[model samples]
Target chain A: MTAVPNGHDGLITARGLYLSFGAIPALVDVDIDLWPGEVLAVVGESGSGKTTLLNVLSGRVAPDAGAVLYTDPEGEQHDVHTMPAPALRTLHRSDWGFVHQDPKQNLRMNVSAGGNVGERLMARGARHYGTIRAEAIDWLTQVEIDADRVDDLPRTFSGGMLQRLQIARTLVTHPRLVFMDEPTGGLDVSVQARLLDLIRTLVARLGIAAVLVTHDIAVARLLAHRIAVMQRGRVVETGLTDQVLDDPQHAYTQLLVSSVLQV
Target chain B: MIRTEGLAKTFTLHLRGGMQLPVFSGIDLTVHSGECVVLSGPSGAGKSTLMRSLYGNYRAGAGHIWIRHHGGMVDIAASEPRIVLAVRRETLVYVSQFLRVVPRVSTLDIVADEPITRGIAPDEARDMAGSLLLRLNIPRRMHGIPPATFSGGEQQRVNVARGFIAAHPILLLDEPTASLDAENRSVVVGMIQEAKARGTAVVAICHDADVRAAIADRLYPLSPAREAA
Candidate 1:
């Protein structure tokens, strides 16, 4: 467990979180704090409970123990664990944006790229077509995808481009906190570099806090301000990206850093 | 090796005034075995159209495509529709970027269908599918779950697993890794490397330089004028 840092407003807090499926524990005794305008990378190997922690924070999976505390833009702290379904849905729609490991799951694959972005605005009741399209195009441009592909189905775009479109769709809603799970996992190495660069730029420009869950240390190093290393549902280490990566105190952190082939 | 000579595809789009638009015309290219070739271009550059022609998804308006398989050289352009279908089903596999998971199908069944459809025993197909799922890191519990219920990355992995099950020698991927996180991307790249190592001739359509740089051994840029050539 890592203590919450001071001064910055805490946007999301998880204390003593525990989750299990059947006889297997996915996460246990996990505590994390996300501050405004900070990008926190959650790193772990496969089945290391990184995705479970993300699901708990985003209200997709209920924790068997403890609480997920989230502060809305209005400065009200709500226990995500206990929120009513409808209230949680509302909070998800208005305040939180989630990007899945696969862009297609987050995006409506049948619709055009613009429609995917516009769907978010429409969900919040922006019905005027032209206004929605304009806003969608603006977001697409921001994400570095061509605005011309707005009418093309996501099926037509390349893998890296589709990821950019997904980013555009999520950010179009202007959510305060974005949760990205392995945002660049399946791209080619060069595309991965470019997409990571785009995410770094957009997170800073939008001033949106993000919790990035990934298994790649290099990805965390590129995009995250703070890094939390997890193993078997426990937060093994958490600190500034440089401190944790360069001078890892925990043995697990040291092992993780050591595994990377330093160029 | 696969070679296209003056292959062309065109579609007439009916506008409000009933005018026509030509989508693509006169494309020529060649792909050799033991090589990974990437087709790159902006939107509407006919990259997908050209790739589709190789598999006979669309009839070529002119010229021909010759594919040298183990048995003999076949004119893909002039092959019978049924023959083309059989060829695509048995020898060529295409993994589109946007996953097309059939409705009401379990993940295991979806993957196993590749082998079963091609005449493998159901039991053997199931065993093979299980092995692939394991290699792809999809949990055993998820094997029986409907693909619709799985997350995006999970579905994509299932899709890849299915595509590779047949051990098709020529695999066509249309932006397979788009929108995936770094871990998933690495997994997909690794899968491609494995496929290549298995002697699959991979033709991938991608715009992301990183993706091409990661997997492509050769690159072909598709421009309107170059497509005419």
Candidate 2:
């Protein structure tokens, strides 16, 4: 299937993606695409295969059928699942980033916050220590963390600070695409708002394409330009975030949206 | 500019056991730069539905809506969500009959919000908001206060101010002067003409014949019709 229009720049394209785990289908004939500088949110209830789809699309999980194709900013196409392990690892450390749902799962708890942010740059071959440190401090400040805490261990930071530190580390390499799984999950309301705001601002400022996996409709509405509603291993509906959420066409989507508690 | 061919819309009432309601069909409407086209007909004519569909508020059941965005023709009916958002930001804008905003947001912020989001300086955006409020006859004293407690006419003026602040290429006004008095209605009519003079294509639904005569470049009539049995 065709992705975005000709005038638009392409980022990622997936076709007929099917996967299973011991007879439990995780993705069934899934087809998705992404354009640069756009955020596409995947939303559904727990156990809907939202996370599985994200993992497969990011090349962390192998699909039983179909392929995930990514076009770099240099105008080169790379098949995500077919690349060599070192090639894929290099791609992950450089051109792509994946943000786990839990901060602890993403960060080095014992490492200094500065080191956490600088390590990605080091992997990308930023040779100058002073420059890496300066960039780390800049990223910490960008995520609203104080520069004085650059050397503090991440385990000592609050939930919000830990999440922000993880984000800073993920974004330090100037990755062209990021796959985030509930970046604001398991946080206080105010902290979630602030972190989501930072993610929104950074994503917009950097023009990074993203596939965000979230169950929160409000979060999707705030951060995503488009949305894909997953239900039991299939994307039941996909369209503009406002259009799909506002006027859901699928029956399952209608029920899912209506079930949200109104604040 | 905006153009549509064979555009149609239908609503399926889920609560009514899936009964389908066809709103309109076979409509060919076009509005060019420096022009205003008004949708004219009776109450059940689907004028509001047509306007909302054109603004990408409702998904069209059939046909194409070709809108000029970023110097290209974008069919909003079929384009992806990112493309639609770009169109709304740069080309298409809509001012509904009512003002819907966050609670306790001052009228000045409501009016200034558009340009500020478009990267205009906050102070300059506020200044533009003040001038537009004053031009709409909304007193400067009321700018800092929320429009929630204001009368319907005043609120409509705030929406008008917000809609015009960004100078988008196309505009859709739905019942802009329904609650306005004779004098303020003329003020809005004048503002609309000014926008048209600035090469803004407009599609509006105004019941007032005088207002229609004053600003309408053409009338696209839509009346309810029976479907084939």
Candidate 3:
């Protein structure tokens, strides 16, 4: 009950959030806040509810009890549990972007590179063909894609390029928050470095508040402004990125940090 | 909050038979929550254009202008107008150099309307607007008067008051203190600091060196695109 911080400028606040998969609990009285313009990394071993917290915060999964309050850009707080379906849909479409672990799962591989980016614009109601095409070119270039490959299908692209395109597609609308789950999980080390650099650059440049879920503490150390260390479906420690990584307070946190060091 | 990557903007002079004029390009910057970023550079270098692009007022020639609005990182350069409008309404709050008000609306009403639209009670909204106006030192007598007859500084104060009332996640200010006197400018600086402490991300343009130095966490110089290194 006393775990959640008080007087925080939370962009998204969860209070007593509880969820379960059948009889087994997924989240137990969890409380956290997604602050504005700061990357709050949820790091833990697998099955620690890092991804589950992400899903709950993003409104992709419903909790059995407790409430999640989301502050819209206009500063009005809405209860996520009872928010209207259309409003929730609009929130998903306009205010949030998700970068999944696999690019193929997020990208329309049969579509051309430009089409993947432009499709988001169309979803937002862009009708003029020329404007959409121009924006697609602009976004493609932003994500480091050559404009000449605008018409090339994503299926033809390499793994890293596909991830970049997926980022372009998700970010083109300038959503208020971004949810990323293991964005660089499967890439080669070199590719992961490059992609992580790009993601770091994009996240910083957009000032987009992010809730990044990762098991890799290195990734968390590299990009997160703050860290929320999860264990047994509960947050065992949370603090500024460097502080939590360097001088961990909780027993679980020290173990987690030391484990990363050992490797 | 706002982020950019290799963001570029240019103007096509159709009157000059489509003579392409490069304003600035290859720009990359980020303004974080509770942080104030001041856009600087010489005039005509597209400092305001960059701010405008973040607000979705101008289309970018190249690169991405990502804004966190509603719940997502939206690319303002490419998102549809409806999506941009939604972001503008809720997430990105912009204060232009001048005030634009509906005809015949009282200054109080104009300022009060923002919070009201955001679902605050009408009376409560008016009270908030009144206090903000008073903080900016607007005369109580003129609260009912239209801002059309106010001086440049007075109008600007009203505009600022209206913008600050929302406490939106991202704030874009264009020459916020251009018309204010020293005292009023100091008040504005304080207001900006308060906004930042509340976790509002701010990107603003200011010609005044003192004001820029006081509020800026960092300076983003928008040099001309032709000089790209």
Tens digits of per-residue lDDT for model 1, A1-263: 35643323588887888888889989888888887877899998899999989988898988999888888777788888788889998877878899887998888889999999999899999999999999999998988888888899999899999999988988888888999999989898878867886787678667788999999988888777778899888898876664467546566776677788844
Clashes of 1: 16
Q: Model 3 over residues B191-216: C-alpha lDDT tens digits? A: 99999999999899999999999899
Tell me how candidate 2 scores on lDDT. Answer: 0.88
Q: Mind giving the per-residue lDDT tens digits that candidate 1 earns over B27-65? A: 667876668999887888878877776766555667888
B14-89: candidate 2 lDDT, tens digit per residue: 6456667788998899899999999999998899989888878788899999999888999988876777888999
Listing every candidate in turn, what is its Cα RMSD in Å to the true structure after a full C-alpha superposition? 24.7, 3.9, 21.3
TM-score, one value per model = 0.53, 0.84, 0.53
Candidate 2 lDDT at A21 equals 88
- State in Å the error of residue B114, model 3: 36
| Residue pairs that clash (backbone atoms under 3 angstroms), model 2 | none
| Cα error of candidate 2 at position B110, Å | 7.8
Quote the lDDT for B101 in model 1. Answer: 44
Looking at model 1 chain A, report the run of 10 residues with the lowest lDDT sum: A1-10
Q: Given candidate 2, what's the lDDT at residue B229?
A: 45
Which segments of candidate 3 are over 4 A away from where they belong? A1-8, A261-263, B1-229
* Better DockQ candidate (2, 3): 2
Q: Highest lDDT among the candidates is held by which one?
A: 2
The DockQ of predicted model 1 stands at 0.01
Which is better, 2 or 3, measured by lDDT?
2
